[model samples]
Target: MSDTPQSVSSHTALDQLRQLIQQQAAQQPLPGERELAERFAVGRREIRRALNVLEEEGRIWRKQGKGTFVGPAAPVQPLMLHDLPQRSNLLEVMEARIQLEPGLARLAALRASGEQIALMKRLLERMQLIALKDGDQHELWDSAFHRAIAEAAGNRLMLGLFDAVDAVRREPGWQHLRELARTADRLHSYDDHHRRLVEYIASRQPQEAATAMREHLLVLQQTLIEAINCGEEEQL
Candidate 1:
């Protein structure tokens, strides 16, 4: 391996180096630090630092003894923002939840064991009980409920997607939608839907379970749209 060239400025050199390595790694395996330093006219230390930054950013991966490899291309994981700017735009998350979760629920219905179904049922009941109480502490239970559904699907990729997107679903504005509903009626209706969803899945009807989940998600979409609109109107 050739000697690595020294970079002039730390930040600029690192950024450029990261781009080059990433570009090259996409096409083929990357060379060692010493070679990279020589090609880029930088020092070995600078190449190492640049590679460190890339690794930190999830842009590359390295193996001890074996040379570093290019990281997997980032999947398109768009943030779901609520259209309403005044309310912090968690609608993007809601949109994603609507699109992905109903299918997950349907899958849960088909694939979940009786124990899984029971756990989901318990989560829904816990959420309902918390919703009935005061002080906005139900978000955790809410997340647990949805996460249980995703977990029941038993697909690693889907579960990872769910995990990646879960935080967005729990945004303050998203929680506030349930908190700010005009009456308990909507919340109660949601709880009822949750129970029915669990039952549909437990019954082992994939199509019906999927349909139920979609319908339930439709309610959620309507709720979010209304909340966003109301928030906008209040700002106006």
Candidate 2:
């Protein structure tokens, strides 16, 4: 706890602070930086770094006029752009998503509220109908559905990660590939896949939910790559 984030090889202070916050009375604002620094036997810089980590992970949020407080387990907002320049790195974006989203699904399995699950179910049903209309609104809800799952995972950081990934997902090229990938059969499967993922979350099976999401993303990745290659072939 005496070390700065640079001096420390691990996030010990961050973990300690996170656990300490959990021990406090629910919904209570944590003490200011100076008090937490004194209590943890760490510098204020280390305490601030730990607080940033907690904030990103969705465990906490700070109000500008007020103090830091715990965020809702299921946040209402769907996205936050991380201010990164957009690039044509569609595969790389999908790679990052595969790495993060399954873990969120796992957390949702353990923590999702019934209301969150119900929202997901409604989104799934709507996506099926919207898919038939062939509109961008469906894709918007596609991102929303995933954001809802991330919120239900009960982690603030995952929501941020999903937000960054989703902002890139809105890029024109990626959107084109997504539309191309949605064949009649694949779109049908998409509904089914969404249903299965929600079912695992509803049933409270973490591993199963993770597996369901991982498999779904893998299929999506393959579809995107195939679409990209096909477009290249057509150009030649």
Q: Among these predicted structures, which one has the highest lDDT?
A: 2
Off by over 4 Å in 2: 1-88
* Cα-based lDDT at residue 179, candidate 1: 45
Across 155-227, the per-residue lDDT of candidate 1 in tens digits comes to 7677667755664454433444544542467768878888888888888877777777788777877877887
Error of 2 at 214 (Å): 0.2
| Cα error of candidate 1 at position 145, Å | 1.0
Task: Tell me how candidate 2 scores on lDDT.
Answer: 0.72
Instruction: Give the runs in model 1 whose Cα sits over 4 Å from its true position.
Output: 1-88, 173-178
Cα lDDT tens digits, model 2, 81-137, are 534425447788889989999999999999999888987887787688777563443
For residue 64, give model 2's deviation from the true position in Å: 33
Clashing residue pairs for model 2 = 56-157, 57-156, 57-157, 58-156, 58-157
TM-score of each model, in listed order: 0.58, 0.65
Worst 10 residues of 2 by lDDT: 1-10
